[model samples]
Every structure is written in C-alpha cells, then in structure tokens.
Target: MNDSARAKPLPTPETQHYWDGAAAGELRLQRCQACSKAYFPPRPFCPACGSRGVRVFAASGKATLYSYIINHRAAPGFTAPYAIAVVQLAEGPRLMTNIIDCPQTPEALVLDMALEVAFQKLDDTITLPVFRPAGA
Candidate 1:
C-alpha cells in the first residue's frame, strides 16, 4: 500500500490540542471545571455537563484493554489479523486504537491487560497514539 492509502487525523481547532499533545509525547485531555469530568476526542465544550469551562490537562499514559476484534481481512493500509481495540484509560475515558508490539491473537490480546502509549509518527506533523502491553 502507498502512503496515500493511510488515513490521517486532521487537527481542527477543537482537537488541535490533542494532536499537539500527541506530537509532544503527551496525552492531553479536557476536564470540566464546572462538573470536574474529563473527556476525550476533543470537543469545544465539556461532554458531561455541556459546560464551556473546560481545561486541558495531561493524562497518564496508562490504560487497560477493554474490548477488541482481530480483523483477519485486509483493509486500506492495515495488514490482516490486526487487533482493533477500545482501551479504557485511567482517566475514565475510552479510546479506539490499534494495539502494537505484540502478537495479534486472542491469547496475546487479553482483556484487561495493562497498556501504555506508543506514538507512531505518520508524517512530519501527525503522530498516531497506539498502545502496547505495558513494559513490553
């Protein structure tokens, strides 16, 4: 596959902080000052209470394997049998991401397994935050 086939995240004003944090090797999330709830996939307002009083904070790069599927069919720029996962972050939010640095099998992709962030730079300005078994 060519680089053009790879899907890249475009940073918008609401999500620019997220992309910038990824580029700087940090996991930035927004917390509502009104209700003290933190959320992800960056939004202009707090998802919890619809409050505009949100603040960006760095999150620990810790998460647990929530759920996943082993995709055995090739698609776009990905190889077959890759795990598409939803990881529950320590900060109370879940993200859909790909697991890396381990065998893509049920035995290896255990639910509730500990994970840490791993950034894969797609270009000069875009970095994807994948996860791997923590300490692997």
Candidate 2:
C-alpha cells in the first residue's frame, strides 16, 4: 500500500505520551496515586477520584484475553477474519487491541488466555499495540 493509503494515527495531547512509549516498545499507562488504580487511554485526570495528579508508568506488557470477536467482514484498511480483542492487562486496565501471531479462528483464541504485547509500526508517528500468545 502507498503511504497515502496507510492508516493514520490519532494523537491528542493526553495520548501523546502513550503513543510515544509504544514507539519505544514500552506500554505506558496512567495510574492514580490516591487509589492505586491503573488505566489505559491516557487521561488528564484520574477517573477514580477526578484527581489530576496521575502518573505515567511503563507496564510489563503482560495481559490476558478478556473478550474478543472474529470479524469476517473486511473494512477500509483491515482484512477479513481478524480478531479484535479486549485484553485485561496485569496492571489493571483493559486495552482494545488486535490479536496477532496466530490464526484468527475460534480454535486459536480462548478466554483468559495469556498474552504479551507486540507492536506494529504503521508510520513514523504511530505504533499500534498488538498482542500474541505469551510464553512460559
């Protein structure tokens, strides 16, 4: 595909740090200092208590399959039969990401399966967070 046809990333001030971390192969998240809660989709304030003193931390990139669906219909920039998954990270956040490094069939995906983070760089400024089966 040409550069113009490739997918573009949407980065806002609140999400810039997270995208930057992904470019460096790190999973970054927002943690509420007061409640000790970790969350994804970086925000300006803590969702638990509306506190603005949240901190950014690098995650271990370990997660478990929370839920998912096998999409058979093709979209503008995606192929058919891809797995769209919601992964529950070990740090206490659920991230929406794609399941890669395996077949997109029902037999290949199981609930609560262990997964590890992987990245797909689409452009100079965007890196997508994907997941794969975890090792022992």
User: What is the number of backbone collisions in each predicted candidate, taken in the order shown?
Assistant: 0, 0
Instruction: Compare the candidates by TM-score and give the number of the best one.
Output: 1
TM-score of each: 0.96, 0.93
Mind giving the per-residue lDDT tens digits that candidate 2 earns over 1-136?
Answer: 2345656779999999999999999999989988888887799899889888899999999999999999887665677888889999999899899988888888989989999999999888899889999983
> What lDDT score is found at residue 24 in candidate 2?
97
Candidate 1 residue runs with Cα over 4 Å from true position: none
User: How well does candidate 1 score on lDDT at residue 16?
Assistant: 93
List the global CA lDDT of all models: 0.91, 0.89
- By TM-score, how accurate is candidate 1? 0.96
- lDDT string, candidate 1, 18-85, tens digits: 99988999889889999999898899799879999999999998999999999988778888878999
